[model samples]
Target: MLIKPSTAIRQDYTGLAELCHSIDEPVVLTRNGEADLVVMSYEAYRRAEARVKLQARLIAADRQAGDPTALLDATSVFDRIRARIDDAEA
Candidate 1:
């Protein structure tokens, strides 16, 4: 959705909000004929944030996978985490 500055400023917010809720992509709000703010649904924002985080995690994991020193069995990792948690609790 492309919104002109005049329409965005003069129109009621309900229509804009409705469009945001219904659409999957972000609504671009233009000002002075240039790109301005972006409007998107809460769920869309959350999903995008999650995807970015997951991508970062995957990249980190890929880097670690190439480093033999960083490798560890799942059980040892869980045990180490549990020990840390127990130490913190104590």
Candidate 2:
């Protein structure tokens, strides 16, 4: 993790932005010696967001798997999905 004082960004915004793009990781900004904000490139932020969404989905699936009553056969699941797609198309 890269840590920088809040003044660093104020003094060199372009340079800090370049650093974020080059490193593809978050830069922690400190204010008064305490953590203040996180700065990251847009692409990195998007990837992080997608990872969080995927993790949530996996957790939901795991919980559902532990409940036998929630289970549905693959064929029925696919058929329902296909029917939805067909309906949308129509």
Candidate 3:
């Protein structure tokens, strides 16, 4: 969604918040016909931040370990998670 900065400044926050939630994506806030800021939901922002942190952690681990062989198989990780879920459900 394209929003003018002046409109954003003048519009009611509740309406803006509703628009952000309903869109489920970043709303482009424009200034002078140019893109300026992006408005996104708090939940979306949190999820994105979590993903970025996870990726950063993985990258750091890779740099420190210096060996791909030390990593567990993806399936093994999923299997462990499944086991934990099953145990919790039992």
State the TM-score for model 3: 0.59
Ranking by TM-score: 2, 1, 3
RMSD (Å) per prediction:
3.2, 2.8, 7.2
Please, what is the TM-score per model? 0.72, 0.81, 0.59
In model 1, what is the error at residue 17, expressed in angstroms?
A: 0.7
Which lDDT tens digits does candidate 1 get at residues 1-90?
655463663596787777778877688878788887888888889999999999999999999999999999999999999999999999
Top lDDT: which candidate number? 2
Model 2 spans > 4 angstroms off? 78-90
Tens digit of lDDT per residue, candidate 2, span 1-90? 999999999999999999999999999999999999999999999999999999999999999999999999999999999999999999
Off by over 4 Å in 3: 1-6, 68-90
RMSD (CA, angstroms), candidate 3 = 7.2
TM-score of 2: 0.81
Least accurate 10 contiguous residues by lDDT in model 1? 1-10
